[model samples]
Target: MAAAFDIGLIVLLVGIGAWMIVVRDVVVATIIFVVFGLLMAIAWVRLSAVDVALTEAAIGSGITGTLLLGAAARLKGADAGGTRLSFPITVVAAVLCAMISASLAAVALLLTYPAPTLAPMAMQNLDQTGLGNPVAAVLFAYRALDTLLEKVVLLLALVGVWSLAPDRAWRGVPSLDTTVPPSDILAFFAQILPPFGIVFAIYMTWTGASNPGGAFQGGTVLAVMWLLVMMAGVMRAPSISNVWLRWLLVAGPALFLIVGFTGVFIADGFLAYPPAYAKALIVAVEAALAVSIAATLGLLAAGPPERMQQK
Candidate 1:
């Protein structure tokens, strides 16, 4: 029965994916893509990879879906018509791709075997690293340099977005004609929500050493809080052209790199924290990253940043 269910899901996924690609309405296609992502998440869970499933549900379906919908709205009424390939050609291409994928999967299933595992080695080093989760230990202690570089890439993307922001002098502060002033009821909710979100974000970051929560999860929660505040008009998106805002955008990655380099000078390896201070350092870095990511994502969603004056 389980095998039959898996095959049914794969068939459904392929059908929906094809429909999504051929759909003429961009908005409908985007919604179908989001549904495809959610279905893929369910498949991951069925395969017993709950962590990957959670990530796919959250980042893949949730965040990406929201972004795509927003982009579709922005592009509405714009020139959407384009060239198309013949249906027969598309069918042939898809068939060839599916055949290749099936062959690869068959080979993998037949040749795969139980291999020597690294769980024991990771467990042995866990005590020295002070991380209860082996994944956390590997991410922060054993392979921290790669994580640091990934953070740097996020920082670079933020900078690139800022650079491409519309000229502030010519555009000036954006008129908030569409932005409604917050009512007392909305303000009340905003006040009550942010503190709770902050507490949750801290909890996630601290508990990440032992459990599923981590910097990415905590950062997303922090972003939610910021989004709430912006929606309530308690805070406005800062102008990207501002020097201080730019600094805040890069602060997390800059601090992370400096700390990692310091480890190289002190411990003779990149990102190697002193044994006594590793936990504290990791916590600090995660906290900073959460703040930076929250700010960057909020600004990105707000479109180009603009100068705001006290009302």
Candidate 2:
């Protein structure tokens, strides 16, 4: 029965994806894309990657879906007179997509005969970081530089988005639509949900050392809560020029860099923590990174500032 269910789900996913591609309406296609992401999350869960599943569900499906829906609304009727591809062009694109898919499948098949695994090495050194979760160790210790660079990239993306703002709105708040009033139900839920969300985010970050939770998952939750409050009009979005907000955005990466540099003098090299305080330092870095991740993700979703800050 389980096998049958999985097969059925895969069939549904393919069907929906085809529908998304064939459907000309942007709103419908965006909705289908959200469903696709949700199904992908389920697939991740079945693979025992709960952390990745959470991220897929939140950022992939939830936040992205919201952004696309907003865009679809604004772009309504803009595609009414858009040109359609010629039949030959459509066929050529289809053929190219099929060739790419076949190539990827062939590569996967070739790699499966002697499937590579990093579990052994990761497990062997997991204790060195004093982290019970091997995934956490890999992220914060074994591959710390990659993780740090990911955070830096997120900050840079935010900077790029801000740079796109017009001169008049450079320091203003970036929001989807300030004039769109929230429904009473949404406002009430926004007010009621943030406290619980905050606690959950903290729990995920703290317990990540031993569980299927981590900075990214926890930060995504925090971002979701902030977005809810802002969208619901419970609180105003912060201005781009707010000193405190800017600091919050950079604090995590700054701390991570400082900790990395400290490793050169105190331990072996960059991002190396002494054996005794490895877990403690990792936790501190996680806490700061979580804050920055949340703020950065929220601001990224908010896009460039459109309205001037009210004095």
Candidate 3:
């Protein structure tokens, strides 16, 4: 029964994804893509990877979906159907992909390894790091250099976006169409939301050391808060071209890399901290990442950087 359910869900997800890819209406496609992410999360849960499922739900279904929908809205009625591939070409591509997938699956099933794994090695060292969760230990303690490099990649992406951004004079600011008075109920809600969101984001980041929460989750919450502030006319998204804003955007990843390199001088290896300070280092990195991610995602949603004054 479980196998059957998993297969059914997989088929459903594949159908939805294909539909989204081929749909002419961008908005509808974005909505379908969100649904596809949710189904992917469920599939991950069924596969017993709760952590991955949480990430898929948060980053995939939540933030990525929101980004896609916002972009679709902005590009509505734009030239959307310029490229076309014949049915024969698509069929050939599908056959090639299926063959590759089957070969990969076969290789995976045939692989053999020693028992009582390196996981135990990681588990034994867990106490030294002060992180209760082994995954967090590996991410922040054992393989922190990798995490730091990943942050660099994110920073590079932000830089690439800035480089591609239009000149300040040609850039347009996003406009909100609502007209709510200061004393209105909606205005009251808007005015009260930012602080609550900030509090929630901080709580999530602090709790991440021992819990399921992490920098990405906390950063996303903060991004939502920033978005709310912009929507409510309390704050405006900063221009991407601003030097100060660019520095702020890169600071998290830059700090992470610096700390990783500094670790080599302070401890046994690059990104390896003294056992006593691992937890603190992880928290600090996460905090910085939260701020940087919030800024990056908010700006991505805001489109091109432009000179604009908040009303």
Candidate 4:
């Protein structure tokens, strides 16, 4: 039964993905892309990668789809085509895609039956870090520096997004259509949904050390909730240059750096937590990271500021 499900899933993924590529309308293609991301998340789950599945569903499907829809709305009727692909170009593109797919499949087929991985060793050392989830142990302890850098990269990406704003709007709020009155359905959900969403995000972050949830997944949910509320006009978007906002944006990385440097003085080395305090420190880091990540993802999806800050 499982095998049959897996096979059907593979076919669906291929069919949906191909449809996305060939779809002419931008909004239609973007919607199909969201579906593709959801299917990819399911594929990851089938491979027993719950962590990857959560990330895929959250970022790949949710936030990315939001971004695309926003873009499509802003550029409505702007030269996006209904034209069919030229025969030769279409043939070439199809051939290239097929070759890439075949090569990837061949590589997978050629791998040893018992694939090489460091998972066993990672599990062996997980107890030292006192994390119950191997994925959490690997992310927050085994490769702490890499994890730290990942958050930093997210910050940088947000910076890139903000840089697109006009200089005069640098201190302004993202134009989340605050002036337009939200629909009844949207406003109703926006009013009631956030409290529940915030609690869920907290649970995801707190339970991460022992379960499949973590800062990234939690942050993504927070981001989605923020965007929803802003779009619904339930809450005004904050100024990009608000001091407190800036501080919240950098809070995670700053605390992470402080702890890492402290490790150089008191523990094994940079980013190292003493065995006795490993879990405690990791949770602290996770909490801080969730806040920063939430803010960053929210702003990124909101796009560059478009309205002047209200005095």
Off by over 4 Å in 1: 1-19, 39-51, 85-111, 115-117, 168-178, 184-192, 306-311
User: Which RMSD does model 3 reach against the true structure?
Assistant: 3.4
For residues 1-311, what per-residue lDDT tens digits would candidate 1 score against the true structure?
99999999999999999999889898999999999999999899897765567567756776677667766876886766756879999899989999998999898788747745787888898877777767678778888878778777776665564555456422333222226456666767877999998899778767877776677667767776876777676766454556776677777777788888889877657788887777777777877776777666655555544444444
Model 2 lDDT vs. the true structure? 0.89
Model 2, 8-36: lDDT tens per residue? 88898889888988998888899999999
lDDT of 3 by residue, 96-139 (tens): 99999899998877777552467888889888888776767777
For model 1, what is the C-alpha lDDT against the true structure? Answer: 0.73
Superior by lDDT: candidate 2 or candidate 3: 2
On TM-score, the stronger of 2 and 3 is 2
Q: Model 4 TM-score?
A: 0.92
Mark the regions of model 2 whose C-alpha exceeds 4 Å error after superposition: 77-92, 176-183
| lDDT by residue (tens digit), candidate 4, 69-109 | 98898678576554788899989998998999999999999
Q: The CA-based lDDT of model 4 is what?
A: 0.90
Q: How many residue pairs clash per model?
A: 0, 0, 0, 0
**In the order shown, what is each candidate's alpha-carbon RMSD?**
3.8, 2.2, 3.4, 2.4
Q: For model 2, name the residue pairs that clash.
A: none
- Candidate 2 lowest-lDDT run of ten: 175-184
Residue pairs of candidate 3 with colliding backbone atoms: none
